[model samples]
Each structure stands twice: as C-alpha cells, then as structure tokens.
Target chain A: MQKDSQKTKLRPGQLSRPKNLNLFTIRLPINALVSILHRATGCVLFLILPVILLLLQFSLSSAQHYETVIAILHSPFIKLMLLGLAWAFFHHFFAGIRHLAMDVHWMTTLMKARYTSKVVLVLGVLATLVLAVKIWM
Target chain B: MLIELLTKRYPGMRAWLTQRLSALVMAVYSVFAVARFLIVQPNSYEAWVDFFQPLWWRIATLLFWISLCIHAWLGIRDVFKDYVPNPSVRDVLDKLLVVSLWVYLVWATWLLLG
Candidate 1:
C-alpha cells in the first residue's frame, strides 16, 4: 500500500535524451524533420527574394550590368548557394504537393505517407542533380 | 451530409482546391524549368537572348511564372490566415499580398524576357 502510494506521488520517469543530432536521431521523426525543413525552406526562399530581385534588376539595367550579374553568378560561392537554393526549392515544392495531397484525402495512409515523403526527397535530389549537372557542365 | 458539414467547418473549398492544383502545376513546371536552364545553359548574353527569343520557350516561361505566382499566393494566404486572427485585417493583408506578388511576378518576367 505504501509502495503504491509512492508510485502515484512520484509520477513517471524523465524521458531520455535524443540519441543523435544527425538525421537518424531517435527523437526526431521523419515527418517532424520534413515539417521543420518545410518551414526552413520557406524562410530561405523569403530571404532569397531580394537576391533574386537584385539579379533581375541588374540583368535588366543594361548589357554591362547583365554581364556583371552573370559574372557574379559564376562565382564558386554563388554556385554553392544556388545549389543549396535549388535543393531547398525543390524540397519545399514537392513537400507542399504532398501536403496538399494529404489535405485532399490522397496518400493519407501511414505507409503511403511515409512512402510519399521518401519519394519526394528522392525526386528533389534527382531534380537538383539534373540542374547541377546542367549548370556546371 | 458529413462532407457538407466538414466543408462548412473549413470554408473556402474553392480556395483550397485551386491552391493544391496550382501547386501541382508549379511542381511539374519547376522541374522542366530547372532542366531547361541547366541543359541549354546560356553562358553568354547572346545565348541567353537566343534562348529567350524562342516563342514557345517564352510561352513556357510565362506559364511557369503564372504557376509560381499562384502557388506563392496560395501558400502565403495560408500563412496569413493562420497568423492573423481578425477577419477584416486578414482580408486586407491577403489582398495586399496577392497584388504585390502579381506585381513582382510581372516585373520579374518582363526583366527576364524583355
């Protein structure tokens, strides 16, 4: 009776810390990671808007400015950033579609949802690669 | 009856449907645009102009721009709806956002192809 009373008073044990900081962490599920990525990508795109606008402004200013913008884009740092942007854009784009599909009652099953998310990630990588190769070559 | 009830609770069925449809369109358009930009890769000003000079390519670019505008509108609308509680304020902001997005899209398209 005393032990039972103590159990009630003590409550549950503290949860263990997450296993890893990497993608394989036990605490962060795939859906949660994707959700976080969606928000992160959205913010990244928001930030990129001004950069995009600057490029457009430069490109439209004159032939000289256009050449300058082209030169800037060809820089290694800019290339890396563009690659990241491409990946994020594709990821957000596909994940948004998946979310919309879920809203409409398509691919809502647990198994299907997992599969769809995986497919979207794979497709995003493939699309990014295609873009990368085209840009680099 | 259940569907009707649910739709009523959500409201804006048309908005939701159009948003999803636009997103799907944009997804496909993005893939193609990325591929096109990569493959032809107009490395020079004349090459870029040549790529843009094609009538069909211009049309495709126009469609992609439209898709992007629509997708962004839908996505931002959701964000505003979620964050803004007052209906009047949300409505005004939503309208403003849509207008601004259209303006930006028009401007960008003109600069790119013009």
Candidate 2:
C-alpha cells in the first residue's frame, strides 16, 4: 500500500518493458498477492460474522429455533457456505499473525516477507481443509 | 482518489495494537471452545445450552464478545478511515458502526443470560 503510487509511476526508457496493467494477465509478486488475499478475506469475514452470530443465537434460543437451525446446517449448500466462512476465518487469522510478525520487525525483509507470506497462505488453506473435513466428513 | 482516501485516516499504532490484542483473545477463545466441543460432544440443543450455562464460560464468552467488537471496529474502521476522508462523514459512519457492534454485544449478553 505504501508504494502503490511508485508502482504506477513509469520510468523513462522503462516503457520498453511490457506496460501490461491488466491484473489478470500480469504476474504479481507472491507477497503482493498474499496482501490482496488478506484484505479480501478480511472483508468477507467482516461482513459474514454477524450472520454467523445470529445463527448461533438461533441455535441456542429455543427448541424449535434449534431444530430449524440444525436442519439448515444439514443442508449441503449451508455446509458449503460454512466451509467458505471457515476459510475466511482461517485466512484472516493467519494473515493477521503475519501482520503481527511484521509489526515486531521480523519478516520485514524482502526474502523473509515472501517466505512468510507463503507460509501464511499455506497454513491458512490447511486450517480450512481441516475445518472442511470436520464439517463435511 | 477513493483509494487515497482509504489509504489514509488510520488511527495509528494504538488501534494497531488493539486489533492484535483482540485477535489474540478471539484465537484463544476459539481453541477453548473447540476443545470443549471435542470433549463434551455438545451436539444436542440441551447440551449446547448447558455448555453455555456456566458462569465462568459465560464470563469468558462475554470477554470474547468485547474483544470481538473491538477487533471488528478497529479492522473495519481501518479500511473506512482510508477511504472516507471527509471527517464529518467518517465520524458519523464510525459512530454508527460502533453503535451496531455495541448493540450486538448487548444482544449476545442477553442471549447468554436469558
């Protein structure tokens, strides 16, 4: 985010390089990609958490509400949505830990940042996989 | 222009620290809740209700709710602060967000108690 302007700035003679500004076509650095995913996941979790809480509340409130909630949970579509929520939670959790590490002056170097970003992404996905199994299997 | 506005207006290091601390709280609570789920097999409605009936668990959950609201506010506000450059609009939006979070927390407390 800090060097966003620097990224768009064109250097003299550097115009010879591909000016591919398309996000889909151009290659992005792994760390940059991780950063984008982190933000995206955060946004999803931010929007989804209230719904999750409401569902939990329903599950606990009354016998009828609990039955209805459990029936909804048994649906495959709801299961899929639950998996998505779990992935969002895991991604946000791992990427948040990475941010905390960066705050501590570690993983600030280019090499370390890239390596850590990869680790965060992998761990996030792994945690989600475990959750998916727990829910689906 | 929107990006620039969004990229600015962060409440700085204090908010950053708060987010981190609240995240820690939530993560720890997740572990505790998951472990209880595994051990107790709280699959039934009565079981789930019983699980949440304890005073200590209720207190821990209340703590988690507080942390969650704070974490959510700091996280969401971080993004909003960056994009909403107009102080008046930002302030209104921020207050609304906080109020909603607080309202949820109160609702959660009632759910736990009632």
In the order shown, the candidates' DockQ scores are 0.31, 0.49
lDDT of each: 0.76, 0.82
Clashes of each: 0, 4
lDDT of 1 by residue, A20-110 (tens): 6575545765776677787678757755765777786677566788899989989989998999999999889888978977887999887
Docking class of 2: medium
Stretches > 4 Å off in candidate 1:
A1-28, A60-62, A100-106, A125-137, B1-11, B85-96, B112-114
Candidate 2 lDDT over B74-97, as tens digits, reads 877877878899999999989988
Q: Give lDDT for model 1.
A: 0.76
Best by DockQ: 2
Instruction: Tell how far residue A78 is off in model 2, in angstroms.
Output: 0.9
Interface C-alpha RMSD, model 2: 1.5
lDDT of 1 at B67: 71
Candidates in order, TM-scores: namely 0.69, 0.81
* Candidate 1 local Cα displacement, residue B81, angstroms: 2.2
Clashing pairs in 1: none
